[model samples]
Target: MVNKPVLPLSPIPKKWEKPLRGTVKINFDAAVSKTKTGFGVIARDSEGFVIGGGYGFKNEEMTGDWAKLYAFEESLKIARLLNITKVTFETDCAKHQ
Candidate 1:
C-alpha cells in the first residue's frame, strides 16, 4: 500500500459589488489578538468612490465573534454620523459557536 500526501484547500476569492444608486455600502472587518482587538469600516457610494471610513483598536482582549460585532457597531455609528439614510452593510465574518 502507498500513502498519499494531502494538501490544504484554498478559499475561493469573492468579488466586491457596488451598491445601487442613491445608496451607500459599508464593509467592515475585525482582527483579534492576544493583547488587543481592532476593527475597520469603509463606506462607499454606488460609483465605487470612498465616502468615509474609520478604524480603531482597543487594549482589551476579545473573541473573534465579539470583535466582528464591535466592527458592525462601529460601522453603524459611522453611517449615522454621516447622516446616511439608505445604507447597505457587508461583513466577512462567519458565524461560529
Candidate 2:
C-alpha cells in the first residue's frame, strides 16, 4: 500500500450580489502592510452601476481588524458626501482572534 499526503482545500469563491432596488451597496476592503495601511470602497446601485468610489492609505502600521474598521468609517463618509440614504455595507474581512 502507498501512503499519500493530505492537502488543504481552497476556499470557494463567492459571486458579488446586487443590492435591492432603490438602494446602494457599498463594498469595502483593507490591506495592511508593514509600512502602511490602505483601504478602498465602491458604491454600486441596484443595477450594479458604480455611483462613487474612493481609496486612501496611511503611512502607519495597523492591525487587520482596525484597518477594516477604518475602511468602514471612510466608506460611511463617502456615502454621506454622496447623499446616499439607503445603503448596504459589505466587507470581506473576518473577525480575527
* lDDT for each candidate structure: 0.91, 0.91
lDDT for model 2 comes to 0.91
- Candidate 1 stretches with Cα past 4 Å from truth are 1-8, 93-97
| Residue-by-residue lDDT tens digits, candidate 1, 1-97 | 9754433246557788999999999999998899999999999999999999999999989998889989999999999999999999999735544
Q: What TM-score would each prediction reach against the true structure?
A: 0.86, 0.86
Quote the positional error of residue 54 for candidate 1 in Å: 0.7
**Model 1 lDDT vs. the true structure?**
0.91
Model 2, range 1-97, lDDT digits (tens) per residue?
9754433245557788999999999999998999899999999999999999899999999998889999999999999999999999999734545
